[model samples]
Target: MSQGVSPAAARGLKYRALRALFRHFGRMRPAARLRLGRWLGALAYRCVRPRVKVARRNLELCFPQMSEARREALLREHFHALAQSVVDRGVLWYAPPEKVREMVALSGYEHLQRQLDAGQSCILLAPHFIGLDAAASRLTMQCPSGATMYAPQSDPAVDAIVREGRTRFNDVHLVSRRDGVRSLLRHIRAARPIYYLPDMDLGRKGAVFVPFFGVPAATMPSTAQIARTWQLPVLPVLSHWDAATGRYHIEVLPPLEDFPGEQDAEAATARLNALLEQWVLRMPAQYYWVHRRFKTRPAGQPKLY
Candidate 1:
């Protein structure tokens, strides 16, 4: 370490540099950003070997019937989507809200709007797609009041940046997952729509085993519990960055009807996974394949990763 520079100063310098870099990308034109992201993504696919393997394993597990050559082609597409999403966070985080709204095209939002107009509470089934952050921003921009759950980053500067960027517009509440269901419900009472991602493998705690792409995955069961208890509409939100247009396309599908009735959490969670698999099949490359979806297997079962 340099003897003259203080630790605080060093941290501040790095934080400022990160902020500058994000803003620099935010200010770029959409076409230019796509070019830069593709260039960087191509480089990353060649150099970032570990994540490539993780993604490849995920693809293999999910699509065992697919040919190796086809899977390899899909892996490259997934990496490009991932890298583009990482670079595009600048647009979702630092760009002007107006500019973000202009770039994002929302479809099938009438499903949500009708529910909101009818004074009914809604739970948005937003999965871990590449355009997740951008979709969250768009929801906050359009919805008057909303809530979402997240675990704060360990780094204070990074957490602060994320919190500020997401909550920049509207009355969007960021409830910590650590706070439990009470905190979530409290925010739900204060808000109408809750943006929930129930697909992550959050270990076995408070989760049930469900079939995800024909594999058992630890899945969240609370979506059904909350929906059943609160009589909230569970609407699916789909998002992806379109390569043909270099913009994000978001759609709010109609709420699921006659769901979770007289059914256990495991059954409900399986239904959720089925829906996710359908969407993922339609846009296989855009799904977040880098995550260890089958990390938590059933008891006495071998690990998939």
Candidate 2:
């Protein structure tokens, strides 16, 4: 009788293949890697029409006043940015720390340091920009100690790689979503800044419908709740790609003042959405448009995606 390899063995083989590919890409010159990424992105834009459609729909929803021609152009640019960021992950995950640091320029770090120096815990409100992973890696170098929650990848091998790559550079704790908010609060209370991404639609649970680009998006109120409950400062951190220089710049804005004081979760969430709109306006193509951000519609409302 012939026996087949187990599922675990098959997964292991796949993980090894992926790891080898990442290592190969990691060794290539940055310029060449980025060029290749752009080519791949262009190819994907043509082949993966569904994602393109989703992106286009998102643009239409967000920018109703903009002409269709302009939106299409932005959509193409967004794909390029998205692909570059994904391909660049090879460098971010496997490259030398010094090299990675060189590729990123950070501003407003003083704001973060001041909070740490004051012995205050704070929240790093990071949005879902294309360069988010790069920015997070860079922040690890400057941050004394930090912790963040991550939604685990379905593939165990991929999940392992992500966890390893994220924690490799800094003293950062990765909390699982299953662990819930309590684990995050425990880390924050220990004076480790929580690098929170509060801009996604994870459904209505622990979220409220707020205006994102004038559309009622299912926005998480956790950021406001966390800050208000713990009296922690909430700082906005945004990352941008400098195409001219082929580098990333992370801007850490100062803490929002007079925030969430006796304010309901919905009110605070709306304020957060307004700030995110400002950031998106500055770099429309850089924001992650492929995600169905408006997927979780209010009760009885038709799906936006």
Best by lDDT: 2
Candidate 2, poorest ten consecutive residues by summed lDDT: 1-10
lDDT of 1 by residue, 1-305 (tens): 01122345346866677768889989999889889888988898899888888889999999999999999999988888888887777887789877888778889889999988887778999989988988988888888888888788887667766776788678878889888766787766754788999888888888888888888889889899898888788999999788877789899999998777788878988988998999999899989988888889899999876
Instruction: Assess every candidate by TM-score.
Output: 0.93, 0.94
Model 1 residue pairs with clashes: none
Error of 2 at 236 (Å): 0.6
Displacement of the residue 118 alpha carbon in candidate 1, Å: 2.7
lDDT of 2 by residue, 165-222 (tens): 7876667888888888888877877899999998888988877999999999998899
- In model 2, what is the error at residue 83, expressed in angstroms? 0.8
Badly placed stretches (over 4 Å) of model 2 are 1-11
Best by TM-score: 2
